[model samples]
Target chain A: MNRRDGDTCSSTPDDSLAREERRLGWTLVAPALGVVLLVAIAPLAWTVWESFHHHDLRMPWLGRSFVGLANYRELLGTPRFWASLAHTAFFAVASVSLELILGLVLALAMQRASRGRALIRATVLVPWALPTVVAALLWRFLFQSDAGVVNAVLIAAGVLDQPVVWLAGTVTAWVPVILADVWKTTPFVALLLLAGLQGIDPTLHESAAIDGAGRWRVLTRITLPLLRPAILVALVFRTLDAIRVFDLIYVLTGGGPGTATEPVALYTFSALMQNLRFGYGAALSVTIFAVAFLLAVIYVRLLGADDGRGGSTT
Target chain B: MDSLAAACRASFLLLVLGACGGGRADPRPVVTISGSAVGDEGAILRRQMDRFMELHPAVRVELRQTPDDASQRHQLYVQWLVARAEDPDVLQLDVVWTPEFAAAGWLSPLDRFAPEAAAFFPATIEANRWDGSLYAMPWFVDVGLLYRRTDLVPEAPVSLEMLPALARAAMAGAGAPGGPPPPAAGWVWQGARYEGLVTVYLEILTAHGGRIMDDSGRVVVDDPPGVDALTFMRDAIRRGVSPREVLTWHEEETRFAFQNGDAVFMRNWPYAAALLADSVRSQVAGRVGVSTIPAARGSGGRPASALGGAQLAINAHSDVPDLAWLLVSFLTAPEQMLERAEAVGQLPPRPALYDDARLAAALPLGVRVAREAVASAVPRPVTPLWSELSERLQIALHSALAGQVEPGPALHTAAADMNALLERSGLRYGMNAP
Candidate 1:
């Protein structure tokens, strides 16, 4: 903002032109700002107010009285809350990191493919195009112990003597969940990184090859350096989504076989919808938002450092 | 010009007042009735509503189909009721939701309506009452009954202790000369982590002579029979009488497995009977039989079943309470109930319907068995914090069934949690309370 101010002051001889430019910019952004205030900020403020009160839909006669930090204190102290937080963190990190590596491979494939490029791209995007709920349901059917084709194929191929209840085990439940999420979202990350791959100059690869650089060396020093920004953007999008994961796990596990695979968002939903404890659920929502905000800030800082190292490429 | 502008403003104000008065003057009130109508049930309900509308043309009844899933429907109702919206004048309530809805002051007491409950099954009517006032009218009734293949078992097991040995023997006889192939599963029921698990557990617990909430509404499940009930379920899985997949089974899963002839026995509601008997959809159409859930060894009482059904209640905020009551009463009338029973296999709440000649001719065995099951049906704990208590119980029963917690500890923990919830809400009104 300071650099922009100095440039405007030096380039314009008259102050009125710069002032008019500023007014025009504000006018252009006014609609977007109004939308953000109405849809995001207003609800966030209401949630904040609600988090400090005693509110249960089924117990309306108790009245919506101020309860201070009681809800927060109870949530923080609960073992289930901490367990859910751990599950959410593991889900986010595992899904994002796995998607990043797989997505990068797909992005490279898309960049190098010389035939049927459109077909390959479209086929890769099919999973992403399907709705999350529908994809989750499909995966649920595939993982069922008795009727699902997964166990049927495995047993037929001598992979197992008996069918395994994939959703009943604490560790095994997460395997299907993570795999389903990766299958659905890796294409999205690939699309973002594919756009970044196109922005790189062909001369960089040509020059690296002329210098006798090997294929792997060229990839590490040149392709990866240019891809940092895209990777960061993809990471932010996927991480935020993974942290707020609810629908997939809700459909697949219903947080069960003993609440082993329950994520924090499902916990929040149980409090809100099932238990009707709005104040506690609001506090949970605020905590989740705060966590996402912290992760975004850290990623943005890393992005800035990456920019300084490579300078602007696009 | 000034007078003309003043005249326009005055006329606009008068028009607004006149519009408000005109709305109040309309006599034909619309009472919106909300409930779930899954599959062909919607068509039957529409026909029933058509008849209702013909009789009372002065009142227009708008029928709305809610989500098929019970939990989703409950959530939608909570959202509407908490906001105090009056659009849904009549609500279709689950039998278990009576205490919770009544305590919230969201449902209008129906004693003033003078709707008779004498013809209805006593247990169904008892479930509708809260604090000596009827908050809902029982529409249809359901009870958990053991469905088995008559070809395999030949006769229902007389006691719970005999089930495992009987199932094992039948499975062994699958390849016997002139015998049908044995199913992969011996027994299956709802065991996933939800309210359905609680109902299933309550049936088994009560059948074993365990009382969750005593007659005075006290917490009483932390006892020997409670532990024994949980152990019996765990043993079923461990002993291979019920497949391990039963842990993940809900109503639909169990129904699918049983109706497909892939299981020897199933514990499900009466709705499964008609579906299983449909020759087009099921392989066990002529072979399946409904029997009461088996009693525990040496228990003198009849085998217990959990009451499962939807009821009709008037929303307290309804603008036309009289019309809502009329719709509720009309929908639950014996004629309509019998029509639904013949059309969709819904069991009527009225016990006299079992003796109705048409119903007996259509499905004689089902009516007789359902009547017996309803007579022994035990209602779960009735409390304002029913949803909360039911959730804790689901966790308790599920954890024990999953081998994550011991039965004794699980039941004790659930009882403690329920007591804490009740005490926190200042609803301590039982002998067990301090």
Candidate 2:
């Protein structure tokens, strides 16, 4: 437009064309970038800002003031935070590991079945299809101390002389929660692993049999090694999902019987929504985001290392 | 050059068209109100709102049914009011929420209306006042009452010690001679870790002459009566007077157990009276009887109960405060209050309404018993920090009942926590000055 100063466009046609392409690319992505900023990045940035202040809605008389790092310092000193962190870690580790093993077993079973293989695969997905809240409620009813069918059957079979209060104890409370989670998500992991199971070539199995390889040898040497990528993917996904568990615990128990099964997410929700302490809740949220971010980085690095080995199948 | 000119003209036309298409305003003003009302209560509210709409044709009133839990309702209001949304013009607040909501400036002051404060119960009016100004209007009154199987126990037990024996006698009489006894629990109340649990603890504590805080805003629960009340609750489970499953029972669960004839006695709010008497839903319809909660032996305290009710408040951000006040006034007027009380067994917000022949004749036992309870019902500590305080009390009480801590130490820990939180903030109940 300012042709009097210099004509850069005429001086280099290639540079002008490249600049036009960059402009078109940014124009195409502007809407997506705007949506991301509005929906995700804006709220995240606001939360980070709020974490540095004392912003409690319920106590508005105590006007919001900048108390940098005070909220984080207070939270770190509180015992409940460390306890909830440990609980979240334990829950994620236990549930993800159980889901992985169970999922692998189910995947193998479905893969081996010659008759009604499709039906078996479809049936395995039924638990995963139900909502997590619904599944948690069902498990809660099943584990009820008095009128639960589980207690009735156990008693009728003489498994115990009396009914056990399944959700009343600290260690026992985690059992039903983990069991419900595993039941709901194991199918997802199985479906992922089943794809890997199918990816193994029939020729490889045939060759192993001709060499007189036993079932154990063929399975360990070929099947598992080929399934490693899928297993890693499923593990990372489920682990992250398990770390942010809130719905199941909220419905089944309100982190109760003396805060026995409270995870960090539930703790943050209680502080933020229930107590209306925005500043403290934001601090807790930032900490959780940091942990999740670190985990994601580690997972990506692991996958990158695996990819460098150059034998990953899809 | 021609293409660029054409593009500019097209963009200008589009902007003009967009501007003209917007700002189509409606002639009628819409007034939206949010509250939580169950089953018949919701229907009644809808009917009343329909009448109000008919009277004022230009004002369209929308009634929003919020979450059933009080804490959830608080969260919903916080979400709306914090964002300064203008849709919900009125809010129904729990009695205990008045202090917190008023202190937060989320509720508009009603001093301009000059409401007839003398028309309502003193305690209900007292609950609506914060910083020397009324922030809400009393909608209805609620107080806990004991429901007993009248066929088995002809007389109301005068003391807490008498309830265990009376419930056991009823259970034994109902049992068959040769086989296992009928499957029934003795006494049931809300034992879940929620706001209801705090109310239950307060009633039990006050029955044994324990106070939560004094007039000067001091923590006063670490006393002998507090420990005794807590120990009594734990003993109720240990002695098999109350079942272990009550640990997970809230209002719904306890209501189910009682209505199904699995419990001999239950402690519940006034709303349960009508629900229990509904023959379609209750097995012990005619047998249900209401009485004031029994007292602690030797302490000589009056029959204690917790004040539980809701109030109506105008949203501070509402654009139509006058219309909102009109709705509140119409809903809480004496005529409407008595109509609700006569129809659904809801206690009127005024003490004078208890003497009405219509209410007395409709439900003689409930009205009489609820009146007595309301006369002496104790209010939980009125403070802006009520939610946090209740959380601590709930955990302490739950831990004590679950056998995780001794009653004495639990009271001490709760008192210490309260003192630390209050002192650290350096703010009193009504003194919100920083």
Candidate 3:
């Protein structure tokens, strides 16, 4: 310290001022860092630690013991675990893609509207505003086999000869689940895209028109290319949310029709809360976290590259 | 502003400390019981607690309201007992949970309390016992029954083979002319993939002479009897004797179908009898009758009803186990059971109660038929791993019913998975015994 101080003696005033500022910044951010460590990092660390143990709350007679990847090994071999992972991936891909396309169309419509735009936007937000569980329940009622409106309408319209048990079929059960997810979250995606649309220069569209670019060409070349960042953001958010989906599917189908629609989060919940296998549940949770984190990292990299190019272009 | 914040914090701390310390000085021992306290159940329980307190004049009993849903309550109790919480000295447990709780050492054995185990139905008593000790007392009993419309069919079907024919005839309006329009479906049961599905399957499985686990604790549900049972259920859905919609129905859904006179036969619990008898809401109000699910033909099997109900047990970590026992015994006594039956239509666990004329009058289903059903009742395998095993079985059964797999293959897979779970948990040996 004395040697460093001697070396910087000539620049002492400025260096000390910089050091003081750095210390003040640290002091200012300490509470937030503490909170992050306490709330987020601590529980995560505990779960990771628990994942290595053999702890079943309902089977305490076995005693909690360190098993060292045994839970993960068991999870890997379990068919139900693999099935649930596939279900999660299928749900995320299916729901997010549908949301993006529908959301993009909705955003374009909203942007082009000149009258009652506020009313249209507000009405579109209603589904998003409703709680996911409530929306899921609403969809469930609509798809019920006997008295559900969907079956009734389909039969009446001659689309079907009779009412189909929507939730009873393994493949058919995913309909309401995906439909509910898309219905509840598309508005948020559209709103994000709408904001992005507003950020685009209207003069760019006018110039494209003067240059003889058709509507489709302008949309494909100018609007879509510029809307890439917003689209990516919405994709990352919705995909992450979709991968960890629980309550909507929980209320709609309960991951049933023989666990056909069970997602990773619901599986973890059953192990943790229902079966009380804390150790196995922790392992399941850690695995889900790892998958979500990997996706996030990929999304962040894409966003970073897009931002750099976007900055250069603008 | 800082001073005011500091004063508020000090006051909050003082308030918490005061509240904690306030209850320490009471001379009378206070015992808390956690259970369903919803609607009439709540009122009856409070009245009983007051009466017990009056009788004792020493120990104070308190009711801690818990979720009415069995699984939710089980989760809450597991959390509390795992934490060794001394309050909620008593717990209301589902029938299948007693063994699990006892094995976990979360329940106090009632052998020391000298409970008269013989008074309760043997199956109910058997369900409450773990490792040669009674861990809980059955407070009430629930047994599955085949509810048929008397006006549609004069008598209950005598056997499983006879059910479809009888149901078809009833659907074709075979009984008296100009009765309620022939029901739309033939039979309905809880076929949803949950615990209720397991219970429904248990009745069928037993009727086909199959057991989930043998007395030696070996998984044998994939055997021929089990396959026959599953096939019978699947065929019901396939043959249109039972509606495919039943694949998504739970107890209440089936009850709704039967209550609306849309089904000729409905399998449900004793709780539905009173609700079905309400003429204002029920179309089959004056037309219902109850019987055990009949034995499958030539299977060497007998009629069986799945055993279910709530059991009361003292928390092993309780500060006042004896007081909790007092509460348990008081609640399970004939008087309280009769009161509960009269008030909420809960079936008493005691076999002798069926002989009581008052019980005959209290239960809308009548004691004789309830007794027969209870007599035929079969408890699900008593093991700490019951919930896990049941979950696997439920999924497998549901998958077969939904046509995702054959009944034989599904049960085989379930059996394999269940056995693996048992072995992995170190319960395949005699580890579960302790």
Candidate 4:
């Protein structure tokens, strides 16, 4: 009837087909785009806009005088901000580095046919499952300078004459916080790396053995190169998490011992939430997000990592 | 004819639905109030709330339990206040917030409600007043007091100067004849760097005949007397007469240490006295003694205690201010105040409630401490801007104690910041060009 049904719309097929393709693709992706805009894009935009205004909780009127970059300028001059950034960088680099190494060892340990492997796997998930606050409180109790078990043991063994306040001085507060973070989040890193290790075929290891590859050589030559993507993914994920840590440090020490434990997130939190300086808090948040995003960019480019869910494996 | 009948019935149903959903008395404002000490005695608050509801019969009240520590409570309460949602009509504001919350305009002033407020303790009354007006009504009161182990010392701290030596001597006695030093704390206080720091610092300053902010409300802590007070705090800590933990101890920790008979002298609130003397936990229950914080300098400048209490205020924006004020008044009435004091450990908001023998018997020591402390308790500066000034005080006191900066500079910093805050708030600090 319309120029024979099988003619494939000879006059209008390409244009119609193109329109159909665009409609189907866009409709399929529209929901995901909407979700991203609602959550990530909208809040980010709102925070950026709020950063330019000066306001507090008492009078919540918007659109004050445009004092461009003044809030950021004031913050840069403040020692607390600079110190907190230094603290954040130190915490991120130290925690993530320790986690990466510890996670590798744990995965390697689990890879071997060790007794109680299932039990260890099950128990390893406990720290990962426990709320961050719970872990912090437990560790805080253990580290109490006066009556804590750690100090008691040290004193009883004649190793030291008296109990040292593990969280007393600014320099020392880092120990308890990093120790808590490592205890709670190291398991997550191990679990991710373990998945990668397990995904590698055992035949590859067997072939390396047949080729007279030593354990060290096999690990360096085959296992590590194969596990690089997983490691990179784990590093990126944990680095982001470590940088934004709040509850663990908040509950453990409360950014105390003279603000030695003050991380950037905690600083922004105290400024915005406790101090009720909304505009300054927004500026600080924007700075943190920018730094974290830059770190992510550096990680992806240098490691050249890809998501494992893609066509190729580690 | 059948279709017309069906249409008539559908329209009737629609009319009923619209009537039911569209307009009515508030279905019940779901309110949440947090308390740490309510415990099993929470029914007292509910029953009192029920009495308020009887007069109105429509407004509902709910009380939520919060942890006792003010810092932890500060974190959650700020989130709610900042959000400024209208559901929580009545808030029990900490006395320290008289400046901060009032300055922020978060509180609805009591002047709008026309409350019957004459019976309240004048200090408590004055404590709730911010600027030239009253913002809240006293619901209860708590003030810091000094506690000592009678076995160690039968007298009050004779003077602020004598405290360090007395603590050292008391500790030596507590140590066994040949055994190691006493496992117990020697002296305990809320030396932790927090809002509590402000309360304790002001107590010392007032005792020393120094004012943090003067009559005209200029920052005046940079003087010699202020430095002397701060020096005493630093020396007390450095000498180890007070525990290293004192630098970290808030009310509960210090209370725990002192109540366990570990401390010879402890500075804390009166609530700890009952718990310590009760057979359940304390070692020095009968042996414990109560008094004021040591005198500052001469007889003229007597020791001043930091007043800690809460109040009930009607939300200005509330559609039912009458009912809200009604609820607030009933909760603070003498009869309910007596019940709240007896059950929830609240010191009565009214001066006359102190005459209730039954209430006193329930909280004997707490009442005694309240009467003595409130008589001379200097309210923290009631200027709306004092909250920012308070944080500056904390930083000053802390840095001075840590030996990071001299007390002179620390107080100077506090003064400058306070002056700026006061200026921004449209208030004059005394030193203005006038």
Which candidate number would show the highest lDDT if scored against the true structure?
A: 3
Q: For residues A1-314, what per-residue lDDT tens digits would candidate 1 score against the true structure?
A: 24466576455555667888899999999999999999999999999999999888767678889999999998898777998999999999999899999999999989999999999999999999997767887888899998788899999999989998888766788878999999999999999999999999999999999999999999999999888899999999999999999988988888887778889999999999888889999999999999999998999999888878766544
The number of the candidate with the highest DockQ is 3
lDDT scores for all predictions?
A: 0.83, 0.83, 0.88, 0.74
Name the lDDT value of residue B230 in candidate 4: 82
Error of 4 at B193 (Å): 2.7
lDDT string for model 3 (A38-90, tens) is 99999999999999999997777789999999999999998999999999999
Candidate 2 retains true contacts at a fraction of 0.56
Question: How accurate locally is residue A69 in candidate 3, as Cα lDDT from 0 to 100?
Answer: 97
lDDT of 1 by residue, B1-434 (tens): 22223335345534643664454455677888878654678788889888888999887766655666678778778878888888689999998888788877889999999979798887788777877788999888878889988888989998988777777887777533565578877888888888888888887887788888765555767778888888989888878888878778878889998887788889998888888888999888888888998888876435988988989999989899998888888899888988888887778888778889878755534667877888888887666678878887887787788778888998898888777777667665541121
Ranking by TM-score: 3, 1, 2, 4
Docking class of 4: incorrect
Q: Residue B258 CA error for candidate 1 (Å)? A: 1.7
lDDT value, candidate 1, whole model? 0.83
Q: What is the Cα-based lDDT of residue B96 in candidate 3?
A: 93
Fnat values, candidates in order:
0.58, 0.56, 0.78, 0.15
Displacement of the residue A191 alpha carbon in candidate 3, Å: 1.0
Q: How would you class the docking of model 3?
A: medium
**Interface root-mean-square deviation, each candidate:** 9.1, 8.5, 6.3, 10.1
TM-score of 4: 0.86
Residue pairs in candidate 3 whose N, alpha carbon or C atoms collide under 3 angstroms:
none
Task: Give residue B81's lDDT in candidate 3 (0 to 100).
Answer: 80
TM-score of each: 0.91, 0.90, 0.93, 0.86
In model 1, which regions exceed 4 Å deviation? Answer: A1-31, A312-314, B1-28, B215-220, B299-302, B430-434
